[model samples]
Target: MKLLLDFLPLVLFFGAYKMYGIYVGTAVLMAATVAQMAIIYAIDKKLTTMHKATLALILIFGGLTLFLQDERFIKWKPTVLYTAMAVALAVALWVYRKNFLKMMLGSQLALPDPVWNRLTAAWVLYCLFMAAINGYVAAFFSTDAWANFKLWGYVFPLAFIVGQGIYVARHLSDEAPAEKTE
Candidate 1:
């Protein structure tokens, strides 16, 4: 459910692009992101910082794309977002001596400090790679190609997530024994 909600805007953007064009696709993306945020807030009663940041990026980049009549702004959005995440993770882990991934997922996942550090490092590197690839695609590809990449490139993240899950599962402990009813 959560995954679908998170991806709804992107799916809509791709569909709109296929049916209409980039400009109309950008408009649909902007509106869809706004709607997604609103729905998330309604359900969760508050938005996470990540959600707010993503919404801000979508609005800013999407607005510029429409206003300037150039698709470059939207094309660069993922690069900006991925780079920011990489920097934030690196800063939080090294400069501040904080493991943000652990902080965020500690309740659901249990791992040693070293494991958490490794996970954080992995995330930072992954984000950097994603940013670089998106930038390369945007700079070298045609707008139509870039748009297609935007939709198809979801595979990278999905694969990364599955790999991460597999890595984490190896270290995961079995559930605590259930208590017997009186």
Candidate 2:
């Protein structure tokens, strides 16, 4: 359910682009993102910082795309978002000596500080990698090619998440109680 909600905006954007083109697709994406956030807020009663950042970036970039009639704005949105995330994570870890990922997920998952540090560093690198790839495609490719890449780009994140899950699983403590003897 949550996963569907998360993908709904991107799915709608791609479908709209296929039918109408970039401007219409941008509008659909903006609307769908708003609806997605509303539904998430209704269910969770609060939005995370990441959620708010995503919503803001979508609206701002989507609005610029529509208002300026430039596909570049929408195309560059992902690059900008990924770059910002990478910088934020890097700065939080290096300059502030704080791990933002650990701060957010620590309550749910208990891991050693070293593991958290490694995870945060991995996230920073992953974000920079994503930002660079998106920027490269958006700059050199045609709009149609960029749009297709945006849709197919799910593979990268899916792989990253699976790999992260595997790494984190190795560090998770076995909290289950031992079997009782007769």
Candidate 3:
């Protein structure tokens, strides 16, 4: 359910691009993203920092794409987003000695400090890789090719998430069952 909501804007954008064109697709994406965020807010009662950042970037970049009549802004948005994420995580971890990933997910999962550090490092590297790949495709490829990659590139995140889950599963500490009270 949540996953579907997460992908809704992208799917709509891809479909709109396929049927119409990049400009129309960008409009559809902007509208769909706003709707998606609204639904998320309704369900969660608040938006995370990441969600707000995504919404802001979409509006800013999408608005630029439409206002300037240039597709480059939209094409480079993902690279910007990924690069920012990578930088934020890396700086927080290495410079500040803070594990932002653990701060975000620590309550949900019990893992050792070393495990959290590794997880944060993995996220930093993953974001960098994603940023580079998106930038490469957006810069060198045609609009159609980039659009195709946008739709197909979901594979990378899905695989990365599954692999992260597997790695975390091994380190997860088993909680003891609570005792029954009369």
Candidate 4:
């Protein structure tokens, strides 16, 4: 349910884009994101920092796209968001000596410090890679291509998440070790 809610805006934006155009798609994305936020608040009673950040970025970029009559702003939104996240993680891990990912998920996931550090590093790198790829697509390709990429490019995150899950699963202590035969 949460996953569907997360992708609702993007799906709507894709539909609106296919039906109308980029401008209409931007408007639809904004409205759908707002609706999603409202629904999430209604159900969860609180929004995470990620939700607020996504809302802010969408509103800002979508508004700019509409106001300027240019699709470039909206296209750059993902790159900007990914870059910001990478930067935040880098700062947290280096300057502050904090692992933001661990801080956020530590309560639910019990992993060694090394594993947490590795996971955080993986996320930071993944974010940077995502930002770079989005930027490349937005800059070198047509808006139509970029829009299509935006919709279909979800596979990247899905793959990353699966890989991360696999890595974490190996470290989970749910299974008992084999007994020695002696």
Best by lDDT: 3
Which pairs of residues clash in candidate 2, taking residues 3 or more apart in a chain or in different chains? Answer: none
State how far residue 4 of model 4 sits from its true place (Å). Answer: 1.2
RMSD of candidate 3 to true structure, Å: 3.6
lDDT of each: 0.92, 0.93, 0.94, 0.93
Mind giving the per-residue lDDT tens digits that candidate 2 earns over 1-182? 87788888999999999999999999999999999999999999999998999999999999999999999999999999999999999999999999998888887787889999999999999999999999999999999999999989999999999999999999998774234489
- Writing each residue's lDDT as its tens digit, candidate 4 over 1-182 gives 98999899999999999999999999999999999999999998999898899999999999999999999999999999999999999889989999988788876777788998899889999999999999999999998899899999999999999999999999977645434388
Extract clashing residue pairs from model 3: none
Ten consecutive residues with minimal summed lDDT in candidate 2? 172-181
- Model 3 lDDT tens row, 1-182: 99999999999999999999999999999999999999999998999889999999999999999999999999999999999999999999999999998888887888899999999899989999999999999999999999999999999999999999999999998973233489
Q: Name the runs in model 1 displaced over 4 angstroms.
A: 175-182
Could you tell me the lDDT of residue 175 within candidate 1? 70
Q: How far is candidate 4 from the true structure (C-alpha RMSD, Å)?
A: 5.6
Candidate 2 positional error at 121, Å: 0.6
List runs of model 3 lying over 4 Å from the truth: 176-182
Off by over 4 Å in 2: 176-182
